[model samples]
Target: MPHYLGIDVGTSAVKAILADERQNAVAEADVSLTVSRLHDLWSEQDPEAWWQAVQTAIEQLRAANASAFADIRGIGLSGQMHGAVLLDENNRPLRPAILWNDGRSFREAQELGAKHPELSHAMGVIPMPGFTAPKLLWVARHEPDIFRAIRKIMLPKDYIRLKLTGAAVTEMSDAAGTWWLDEARRDWSDAALAATDLNRQHMPDLVEGSQPSGMVRSEIAAQWGLQGDVVVAGGAGDAAAGAVGLGAIEDGSAFISLGTSGQLFVTTKEFSPAPEAVVHSFCHAVPGRWFQMAAMLNAASCLAWTASLLKRDIGDLLRETEAAYRSPSNVLFLPYLAGERTPHNDPYARGVFFGLSPATQQTDLVQAVLEGVAFSFADAKQCLEQAGTPLTYAGMIGGGSRSAFWARIFASVLDVPMVRYQGSDKGPAFGAARLARLAATGEAPEAVCTAPSILETIEPQPQLVELYRPRIEAFRNLYRALKPEFVRA
Candidate 1:
C-alpha cells in the first residue's frame, strides 16, 4: 500500500495529499483560490487559477482515495517561495503568478540589487523582484512583448513541473530562492546568468529537491484517478518544504515560518551571506546543504490586521487576550505591518504601536500581536545568529503556530525551543509527504524525517526567558530607530 503524493502549491489554495508509509494521512484534498489583489501591493495568481486548483484538488483526492490513487508511488512538490512564474513560446502563461506576497517588485528589487553587486557578492543573492530574477526584470521592463516571448522560467513548482512532467524543472529547494542560485556554487549563477541577460538556455533544468523528475501527465493521470506510473519528485521550497514539514532537515535545526511572509529557517553547513546583505543564503532541501534564511515581511499578517481592526475572532481575539501571556506589556510592536524584510530590507517599514496607552487592552492588543510576531521573529533570529548560524532547536510551522498564547510568545521571543506541529497537514504537505517517503525507500534525510512523527514540543518558559531578554533589547532598538524613517517612507 505505497501511496505518496504531496502537491501543496499554496498561498490561497491547491493542496492534494495522499501519503501513507509512515507519513500517515491516507487522504486529503484542498481547493480555495482567490489571490488577484489588482492593486495594493499586488499579488496575482491565475495560472488557469492554479490549474483549476490543481485539477480540483486532484479530483477530490482521487475520489476519496479510491484504492489510494492506485498505490501512488512517488510525487513531491512544494511551493510559494518568491514566486514569479513566467513562460511563453507556447508553454503558455506569461502573466499572473507574481505572488510571494507581491510588493510591486520594490523598484524591481532595486534594479536587481543595483545591477548585481556581483549577484550579491557572488551568489549570496540579488534575484529580487520578489525573486525569479527580479520577476524577469519586471517582465523585461514592463512586458516587452512579454519579454519577447520568453521560452521558460518557472516557480510555483516550476510552473507545476511544467504541468506535471512536460518538465521544465527547478529544484535545489526551488533553486535556492532564485536570484539565480550560486549559493556558493550549488548551481547556475554564471555570474547570475551573465548578470541577468538570464537565458541559461532559458533556465529550468536544475533539479535535486529529492529526485525523479518525470512521468505524471498521461492525460493528467487519467484526468485525476491516477494509477499510472508516478515519479514526480525533486520538489521543495515552501520554506524548504516547511523545513521538511517541521523536521528541519538536521544541522542546527530551526524553523519559524509564520506564513504570508515570516520565516527564519537557519540550518547550515555553510552558505551564509549576511555581511549586511541581511540574511538569505539558500540551497537546502537537504541534499548537499545550505540555508540561512531570515525573512519577516510581516508575521501572522499583523495579527490578521489586528483581527480586522478589532472586530474580533482571532479565536475570539486570543480569548480576549489570554492574560497577555502571563502579563508584561508596556507595549511596543513594530511588526512592520508591511515593509521590512530580514534585518531591515525596508520596503518602507510601517507597522507600529510602539508603547500604546490608555491601559492598552484587548489584552494590550493581544500583547501587541504576540509581541509583534515575537519581535519580528526576534529580528530573524538575530540574522541567523550573526551568520554563525546556530539555532539548535525550533521547528514551529505556520498559520502562526495556532497560538498557545502565540506559542508562549514564540517560546519566550526565540529564547528557543518551539518544535511545534499540532499536525493539520502543515507546510508543503508535511514536506511533500516526507519527500515521498524518501523517494520510496532509500531513506535517511534523517530517517525520512524522523519517521514522520514529531507532533508536539514547544518548551521555553524560564520566567518567559526572564521576560524576553530586556524585551529583546527593546525589539532590537525598534528596528534601529525605525531605520532612517524606514528608508524615507
Candidate 2:
C-alpha cells in the first residue's frame, strides 16, 4: 500500500500525518518543541529541537505497522513562515533562529522602509521588522560575526527540507513571506535585494511548493524505517497549507483560522495588494495562484491569556458558550495580546476590555473573546474587499474552530457563513497530505474535495449582524486609540 507523509513544522511542534493515495488520513503523530523568549521581545528556538522532534514523530509513526512507510510515495512539508534560519558556509545554523513571534526587529523594519523608499513603493508596502528581510539586516548590523558566517539563509521548513533531501531550496509560497520576493511576479525582487545590505547570494534556490525538492536521503530514510528514493515535495507556508487543508483550493474561498494567532486567508487568482496595504499577498501552494491574508497578532493567544487568568480549560469554557450565544454578551474583548497586523499595520496595539461591568459573567468574557477574534477576520475580509478580493463564504478551521459556538459567532460577526471541520482541523497537516497525494498520483486538490460534507453553515441573522455592525465599528476604532498607549506603556 503506497502512502504519503505530510509533515508540518509549527511554532510549538512538528506534526506528521500519513495519508493514502486517495488523500485519506490514516495515522498521525505530533511532537511539541519549545520557544525561548528573552530580552527585547525576542523569540528564539533551537533548530536542533525541531529536528529531534521530527525524528521522534517519525519513529513513533513508523511504529504503526499497519501504517508503515515502506512504500510511502512522497513527503510534504508545511511550516511557520518568516522565521529566519541563518547558515554558515557548510550550512550549519549559526545561532538560534529568530522566529515570527519575535518583536525585536521593529527598528530594522523601519530602517528598511526608510533606506529603500523606491523599493518599498514597488512592493506596495515597507517591510516590517518581524519579516525575514529586516531580521537579516538586524543580524548584519548588530551581530556581524554571525552574519558574515552565513552562506545560505533558509526558512523553517526549508531547513528541514535541506535535512531530508540534502538540497537547499525554498518554495514560492514560503519565500513570498520573506518580504524579499516580488510577490506579484513570483520571484526575487532585485531592487528590494539591492537596497538591503544583506547578500542575495546567501538565499537558497527558489521553487514552487508543489515541485519535488529531491529524493529523501538514504540515511534519513533508513533512520525512519522507510525506503530511500521517496520523492519529497517542498510544502507551502502555513497559510497556504492551512487554506489547502480547509479545501480552499480556488479563488472565492476563504478560511478563518483560529490558532496561535488569528488569520483571515482568502484564495486569489493573481497578485493583488490591499489598497491600505494592511494585508499580505503571497503565492499559493496550488500553483499559479495567490492569497490575500489578514493576520491578527493574537487569536487563541487572547483566549489562552483569558483562560489562564481564570484558570480554566478553553474547551470547558467554550462548552459554557452554548447558552451564552443565545443572548449576546455585554462585554467586548480586544484580541490584541501582541498587537495586530491587518487593517492597522500597528504592532503597538494592545488588548483591552472595552465594555465591562459587574454584570459581565465568565460566559460574557468568553463570548467577547470569541467575537473579538472574529472581529479581526471581519477587518481582514474588509481589507481584501479594499483590494477587490472576492469572498462569498468562509471555512473555519484550527484549534478554536473546535468550539461550535465560536464558529457560529465568526459567521455571525463577519456576516459570512462558517464551517465546522471534523477530523484533522490542523490545516497544514491535512493539506500536506493532499499535496503528497498529488505528488504521488497527480490528482487536483479540488477533485479530492468534491465530496462535500459541511459540518455547519452558520448564516448571519439580520438583527444580530445589524447590532454587531456598530459594535464592530467601535472595536476597530479601539485598537487605534490603544495603540499609542501600548507603545508608551
Candidate 3:
C-alpha cells in the first residue's frame, strides 16, 4: 500500500509522520528546535536549523519504518505562519527568520495600517507586527543592505519546500497570513505588496494547498529510500493545517488550537473580513474556502515557560494544580510572555501575576498560568463572536489538548463544548498527511478530510462556568488596568 508523509516545521520542533492509505500513522519522529531571543521583543530561528531538524526527523521516520518510508507517494507541509524567511539571490537566508511572535515591527505595522486603511478589507486584516509584510517594512528600514539583496521571501514551511523540490512556491492558506494576499481573490494583493516596498517578484509562485507544488527532488528521494515521483502538496500554515486536521472545512465548522500560539478558527464559504474586531480573515487550505480566526500569540508556550522557570515536570505540576483547583485562581495572570496578538495587539504587554499573596503556592501559580491562557482564548472567542462567527462548540487540538485538565478549563471559560478527537495531538502533521493523500490521489476533500472518531466531548459545568464568568471579567479588567503600565514599561 502507498504511504503519505507529513512534515510540520513548527516553532518548538520539527515533526514528521508516515501514514498509510487509511490515514493511520505508521511511524513518526520529532526533532526539537530552539528560538533565539537576543533582543527584547525579538524571536528568531536560523533557517538552516529548520532544514537540519527536518532531515533528522525524516531520518528517524525512515529508521522507524523503512518499508513505509520507501513507499511514500506524496508529502505535505505545515508550519508556523507569518515567519519572515528572507532569501538572497542564491536562495540563502539573509538572516535568522523573524518568527510569528517577534514584535519588532510594531511601529512599521501601525504605519502601514495608517497609510493603507483601504487595504485592510482586501488583505483580510489590519497590518500587525507579526505579519510578514510589516517585517519586510522593518527590514527595509533597519537593514537596508539585507533588504536590497532580498530576491525571495518564504514562510517557514515553504522554505523547506524549496529545499525539498528546489521550487519557490507557497499556497493560499500560508500566503494569507503574510498581509499580502487578497483574501477575497485568493491571490497576492499588488497594492498591499507595494506598500511594503515589494512586488510579486518577492513572493513565491502560488498554488492551492491541495494541489501538487512539485515533485520531491531525485537525490532527496534516493537518500530517503523513497519510490518514484513523489509529489509535494501545496500545504498550509499551521493554523489552517490544524483546522484541516480537525476536519473543519465546512461553513460554520469551528475549532480551537492550543499550540505554541493559539487560534479560535471558524470556517466560512465566503470571504469575511473583520479587521476592526482584530480577527484574522484568511484563506483555508482547501480551495474556495476562507476562515475567520482570533489569534493569540501566547498559549501552550506560556505553560512551558512557567514549567521551565519553576524547574518542575509539566505533567506533575498540572496534576498538582488540578488537585488543588477548588475554585478559580485568586491570582490572575496575563499570558503575554511573548506579547499578545488578539484583542490587544499590544507588543509591549508583558506577562503579569496579579493578586499574589503570602499564601500563594507554586500550584496556584501553575493554575493561574493555565487559566490565563484559557482567559486569552475567552477573549479570542469573544472576538470571533464579534466577527459574526460565534462558536457553540469547537474541536480542540494541540500539545495542550493532551491535558484533560486544560480542556476542562477551556470549556468552562468559553462556555462551550470542546470536542477532543482520537490522536488530536498529532495536529498539523496528520492534516498534512491527509493533504498529501489528496494531492496524490486527486480525491475529493469531503471524502478524504473526514473528521476522526471523537474521543470525548468536554462540556462546561454550569457552576464552574458561572464561577469563571466573574474571573474572566476580572481577567479583562486586570489587562485594562495594566495596559498603561505595559506601554510605559
Candidate 4:
C-alpha cells in the first residue's frame, strides 16, 4: 500500500510522520530546535537549521519504518505562520528568519495600520508585529542592505518546500497570515504589499492547501529511498493545518489549539474580517473556507517555563497540582510571558503573579499558571464571540491537549463542551498527512477529511464554572491595572 509523508516545521521542533492509506500514523520522528532571542522582543532562527532538522527527522522516520517510508507517494508541509524568511537572488537566506512570536516590529506594525486604515479589512486583520509584512517593513528600516538584496520571501515551512521540491509557492491559509493576501480574492494584494515597499514579484506562487504545488525532486527521492513521483501539497499555517487535521472544514466547526501559542478557531463559509476585535480572519486550509481566530502568544509554554523555573518535571508538577486542586487559585497569573495578541495586542506586557502571599507554595504557583492560560483562552472566547462567531463547543488539539486537567479548566472557564479526539495531540503533522493523501490520490476532501474517532467529551462543571467566574474577572482587571506599568517599564 502507498504511504504519505507529513512534515511540520514548528517553532520548537521539526516533526515528520508516515501515514498509511487509512490515515493512521504508521511512524514518526521529531528533532528539536531552538530559537534565538539575542535582544528583547526579538525571536529568530536560522533557516538552514530548519532544513537540517527536517532532513534529520525524515531520516529517523525512514530508519523506524523503511518499507513505509519508501512507499510514500506524496508529501505535505505545515509550519509556524507569519515568519519572514528573506532570500537573496541565489535563494540564500539574507539573515536569520524573524519568527511569528517576534515583537521587534511593533512600531512598523502600528505605522502600517495607521497609514493603511482601509486595508485592514482587505488584509483580513490589522497589521500586527507578528505578521510577515510588518516584519519586512522593519527589515527595510533597520537592515536596509539586506532589504535591498531581497529577491524573495517565504514562510518557515515553505523554506523547507524549497529544499524538497525547488518551488517557490505558498497556499492560501499560510499566505493569509502574511498581511499581503487579499482574503476575499485569495491572492496577494498589491496595495497591501505596496505599503511595505514590496510588490507581487517578491511573493511566492499561491495555491489552495489541498492542491499539488510541486513534485519531490529526483535527487531527494533517491536520497530517501525507492519512490515513484511524489507530489508536494500546498500545506497550511499551523492553525489551519490543525483544523484540517481535526476535519474542521464546514461552517461552525471549531477547535482550540493549545500549542506553544493558543488559538480559539471557528470556521466560516465566507471571508469574515474582524480586525477591531483583534481576531484573525483568514483562509482555511481546505478550499473556499475561512476561519476566525482569537490568538494568544502564550499557552502550554507558560507551564513549561514555570516547571523549568521551579526545577520540576512538567508531568510531576501537573500531577501534584491536580491532586492539590480545590477551588480557583487565590493567586492570579497573567500569562503574557512572550507578550499578548488577542484583545490586548500589547508586546510590552510581561507575565505577573498578582495576589501572591507568603503562603504561596510551588503547587499554588503551578495551578495559577494553568489557570492563567485558561483565563487567557476565556478572553479569546469572548473576542471570537464579539467577532460574531460564538463557539458552542470546541475540539481540542496540540501538545497541551494531553492533559485532562487543563481541558477541564478550559471547559469550565469557557462554559462549553470540549471534545478530545484520538491522536489529537499529533496536531498539524497528522493534518498535513491527510493533505498529502488528498494530493496523491486526487480524492475529494469531504471523503478524506473526516473527524477522527471521539475519545471523550469534557463538559463544564457547574460548580467549577461558578468558582471561575470571579477569578476570570479578576484576571482581566489585573491586566488592566498593570497595562500602564507594562508600558512604563
Candidate 5:
C-alpha cells in the first residue's frame, strides 16, 4: 500500500497528487498562487509564496487521506520551466522570481544573441526574454548590487527542493530552457554561460529526470506526516513531465498540450537540434532521449480573454460556440495575447481580430479564437515536420483539450487524428508521481510507464481540413501585413 507523491509548481498554483502502485491517483490537492505585475511586461512571484503553497498543498493532501499520506514512499517535482530564482549564500531568495512569461528581459535576450550569433544553434533555442539567461543578464546590468550578491540560481521547482532538502540540484530537461545548456551534450555550455557573465559554479549539479536528487528532511516529513526517508526524484520541466504523464516517452511519440501556453512536443531517440526552424530541442525526461518542441505563447488563455472581453462565463461561451465552431467564419484571430514564441519568436506580437464586420456575433468571435489556436498548432506541427519529426498522430492534453469542439478544430487543422487517453488530465503532477515510484522501488520506467487506455480518437474532417488550409495561409498573411503595425503600436 505504499504510495508516491508528485508536486507540480505551476504558474498559477501548486498541485499535489498521490498515486498508488496500481497507477491510479488516490488523492489530489492544490493551493493557488499569485503573480505580480508591478511594471509593464514584468511577472514576478515571491519564492517564499511558492514554498508556502507547497506546504499548504501537502497539508491539504495529508488531511484528506492521512493513511495514504503516511505511507508515502517518495516524492517527485515538476514546475513551470525557465523561471529565474536567484539565491544568496544562505539559500535565501535575493529577489522575487522572474516568471517564464515575463518579457522584461527582451533587450537582454537580443544583447546575448548579438554577442553569440550562433547561440540558437548551440543552445537549440533562440534566446527569449522568458529564458533564465536573459533574466540574469538583466539583473546583472540593472540590479548590479543584488546581482553581485548572488550565490546560486535555480529553476522554479528546484527552489522548492532547496527548502525541502537543502540541496540545489537540477535535471537536464529543465536546464535546457535556461539558454545555458549545451543540449546536444546534455550539460551546461561554457560559452553560453560566459555570455551572461556566469560560470559553471553558478549552476546546480545536473541529473537525469528519473534519478534521486535528494531526500526530504526529517522536519518536513514530520510536519507533513510522512515517512522520514522519502527520496526526491530529479523531476522534469512541465513540458517534459507532462510528456511522461501522457506516456509520450518513446521515440516519435508526441502530444499537443493546450495549457496557458500551448506546445507540440515530439520525442526523439537522438539529439536533433532544429534551431534554424525556431523549434526547441531539449533533453527528454526519459534517459538517453531528446525532444523537439514548437510552442505558442497563448492558447487556452486566449479563450479566457475572449470570455472576459464579452463578459460571459467561459463554459457558457464554449457551449454556445459549438455550433459556430462547426461552421466556417470569415473572421480570424491571432492568438498572440502574450506575444509569440515558435516560428516568430517576437515578443512584440500582439493579438488581433481581423475581418470583423457589422454582422459579427459573440459566437463568431469565440469560434474565431478556437480556430486561431488550432491554426497556431498547425504552424507548430509544420515546424516539427520540417525538422524531420514526422508525426502521423498525437495525443491531446490540458484545459483546452477538454473541449470536444476545440479538439476537433485542432484535428481538422492539423489534418491528423487526436487521441485522448484515459487519465490524461492529471498532467505533469501524475508524471512526477510515476517518476517518484521509479525512484522509490528501483522499477524500470518502461515497465511502469505505458500509455493509458484509449478514451476516444478524434478523426479529422476532410472538408474542414480543406477549408482551413486556405484560412491558414490567410492567417499567416495577416500576421505578415500587420507585423509592422504591431511593432509601431
Candidate 6:
C-alpha cells in the first residue's frame, strides 16, 4: 500500500501524519514549538526552530512505521496563516518570523487602509496587523537595515517548503492572507505589494494549493529514507486545508475550526469579498473554488486560560461546564483575548466578562467562556450569510470539537447541525496528506477529497436556540458599548 506524508507547521507544534491510499492515518507524530513574547502584543518564532521540529516529527513517524514511511510517495504542507517570513539574498532569514498573533503593526495596518482604500476590494481582506503587508511596512519603518536586505518573503508553511524543495513558492490559500494577492485572479497584486514598498520580486511564485510546487531535495530525501523525486504539493494555509480534509471543497460546503484560534469557513463558487464586515474572501485549496472566512484570534485558548485562572485542570473545568449546560449563565464573555478579526478589526479589543455577580461560580464562568466562543462564531456566520453563502450545517474540526457540551452549544447558537468526523481530528495535516495523494497519483480532487466517515452530528436544540437568541443581541451590544473603551486603552 502506498503512503503519503503531510506536515503541518502550527503555532504551538509541528505535526506529521502518514496516511495510506484508503485515507486511513497509519502513523502520526508531533513536536512542540514555542512562541516568543519579548514585548507586549508581539509574537515571534524562529523559522529555524520550525524546520527542526518538522525533522523531529518526521523521525518519530519513521520510528513508528518504517515501512509505511519509506513508501511515502508525496508530501504536502499546511501551516498557520498570515505569518511573515523574510529571507535575505543568501536564503537566510533576516530576523525572527513575525507571527499571526502579533499586533505590533497596528498603526501600519491603519495606514494601509487609509492610503489604499481599493486594497480591501482587490485583496478581499481588510489590512490587519497580522497580515504580511503590514508586517513588511513595520519592518521597513523600524528595521530598515533588515528590510533593505530582504530578497524573498513567504508565509510560514512556504518557508518549510523552501527547506524541502530548495525553492521559494507559495499557494493561493496562504498567499490570500498576505494582503498582497489578487485573490480573484489567484496571483500576486503589484498594487497591493506597492503599499509596503515591495513588489512581486519579493514575493514567492504562486500556485494553486493542489498543484505540484516541486520535488523534494536529494539531500533531505536521502536523510528521511525517501525517494528523491517525491512530489511536493502546493499545500494550503491551515483553514483551507482543514476544509479540504473535511471534504468541504464544493460551493456551500462549510466547516468550523475551534483550535487555538477559531474560524468559520464557507466555500463559494465566486470571489465574494466582504471588507466592511472584515470577512476574508480567498481562494480555496481546491482549484476553481473560493472561500469566505471569519476568524476569532481566541477560542480554545480562552477556555484554557479560564481553567488556569480557576486553578483547575482543563478536564475538570470542562466536566463542570458540561453539568451546567441546561442552566444558562447570565455572565457573558467577550473572547477577544488576542483581539478580534471578523466584524471588528480592532487590535486593542480586550476580553471582557460582563454580568458577573457574587453568586457566580466556577461552572458559570466556564460556561460563559464556552458560550462566548460559540457566540463569536455565530456573529461570523451571520456576516457570511449576509455576504452570500448560507451555512445551514458544517463539519466541525479541532480541539473544541471534542467537547460534547461546547459542540451542542455551537449548534444551538448557530442554529445549525455540526458534524464531527472520524479521522478528522488531525485537521490540516490529514488534509495535506490527501493533497499529497493527489500529487503522487494524479487523482482528481473530487474523487479523492471525499468527506471522512461521520462520528456524530449535533443538531440544534430548539429550546436552547430560542434561549440564546436574546443573549446573542446582548453579546453584540456589549461589544458596541465597549468599542470606544478598547480604542482608548
Q: Which regions of candidate 3 are displaced past 4 Å?
A: none
Tell me the tens digit of each residue's lDDT in model 4 across 1-489.
Answer: 999888999999998889999888999999999999999999999999999999899889988999999899889999999999999999999999999999999999999999999999998899999999999999999999999999999999999999989999999999999999999999999999899999989999999999999999999889988578999999899999999999998999999998999999999999999899999999999888999999999999899899989999999999999999998999999999998999788888999998789999999999999999999999999998888988899999999999999999999999999999999999999889889888888898889889999999999999999999999999999999999999898
Clashing pairs in 6: none
lDDT of 5 by residue, 1-489 (tens): 999999999887898899988988989998888889898678899999999999898888878888999999889899999999999989888999999888888999988888897878868888889889999999998999989988899999999988888899999999999999998888999999888888998999898888999999889888888765899999899999899888888989999988778889998998888877889999988689999999778888899889989999989998888855556669999998878888888877889999999999999999999999989988898898888888799898776777877888888899999998787777889989988888888888788878888889999999989988999999999999999987797
The root-mean-square deviation over C-alpha atoms between each candidate and the true structure, in angstroms, is 18.7, 2.1, 0.8, 0.7, 1.4, 1.4
| Better lDDT candidate (2, 4) | 4
Model 4 CA deviation exceeding 4 Å by range: none
Using TM-score as the measure, name the better of candidate 3 and candidate 6: 3
Which stretches of model 5 miss by more than 4 angstroms?
A: none
Query: Across residues 41-129, which tens digit of lDDT does each residue of candidate 2 receive?
Result: 68889887888888888877778744456778888898888899988888889999998877777888887777776665345346875
- Mark the 10 consecutive residues where model 5 has the least summed lDDT: 320-329
**Which lDDT value does model 6 have at 362?**
88
TM-score of 2: 0.94
lDDT score of residue 476 within candidate 3: 97
* lDDT-best of 4 and 6: 4
* Full-model lDDT, candidate 4: 0.93
Rank candidates, lDDT, best first. Answer: 3, 4, 6, 5, 2, 1
The alpha-carbon deviation from the true structure for residue 455 of candidate 2, after best TM-score superposition, in angstroms, is 1.6
lDDT (Cα) of model 6: 0.89
TM-score of each: 0.37, 0.94, 0.99, 0.99, 0.97, 0.97
